[model samples]
Target: MTESQDLDLTPRDADDVSVGRKRLRNWLIMGTFTAVIGFVLFQALTSAAQFYYNVDEAVARRGELEDSTFRIQGTVTSEQAPDANGALIFTIAYGGVDTAVRHVGAEPSDLFEIGIPVVSEGHWEGDVFQSRQLLVKHSESYEAENPDRVEYDLDDTPGYVPDNTVE
Candidate 1:
């Protein structure tokens, strides 16, 4: 036979081609799935992470922080009644430095008051810190020891009388 006739020019078996195609397809699917999962985890972690700082440290780094969201811990040195828009304005102090905060959200619990420590979460706007959430810090032991102590203002509660008061 001639050399040209002896050469096997016909295509390879169907099974060989199909096996290569299936392997490539599986790899593509796995790669896409891994990429998607990685992206989702990155987003969740970044959004959940919150940097914490004291009032004095936050004030010192105000220029660097700018509009970034964070948490500040300090004692509530002063507080104002709800404003016209129902925002509670207060001042928190730490290490002898004070930062003003404008809280616009649900009213804080009875534990929130002047002289109490708190952690405010939000970003700084101009010279004041605009907060959406407030966390009050109180000792459970203190409450247990002073069960009779009135922590909240009585005048604010309309028609509510204290049973422990002397008639």
Candidate 2:
């Protein structure tokens, strides 16, 4: 056979080259898709995660955390009243440190009051925490430990007297 015939590429060689190109394209597409999915999941998880801190820690780290949203836990130490924009303003204390919070959005549950522990979620606005969500921390053990102390309206449960009621 001549040198030209010996070096000539066959139809089978062309088919193999086409198959190799297709495989590389598929791999590239799959890699791009996997990368995109990974990036989306990372962003979703990171954005949903929030750092929790006590009032004292939050106060101490105010400079570092001023721009980030986080959760602060403390006992309500002041009266809760509405501000000019109808936001509830109050003070919370933990570990002898106090921080003021201005809560906007939905009102907290009835359990929210002075002395109650609450976790507020928001970022700092100046020296005050601008909370968009407030969660009251309460114990379920109160009803279990003191069944008789549970207060019920006289109309709702007739003849059931609460422990605080005068005889």
Q: What TM-score do all the candidates reach, one by one?
A: 0.58, 0.57
lDDT of 2 by residue, 1-167 (tens): 58766785656656878989989999999999999999998987886565478888998999998678899988776655586899998887777677789899888999987667788999998888999999998855464556667553332322221232211
**lDDT string, candidate 1, 4-99, tens digits:** 778976566657778799889999999999999999988878765654688889999999999988998877766787889999998877766777
Q: Number of clashes in every candidate structure?
A: 0, 0
Please give the lDDT score for candidate 1. 0.77
Identify the candidate with maximal TM-score. Answer: 1
Give per-residue lDDT, candidate 1, residue 83: 85
Instruction: Provide the lDDT at 52 for model 2.
Output: 70
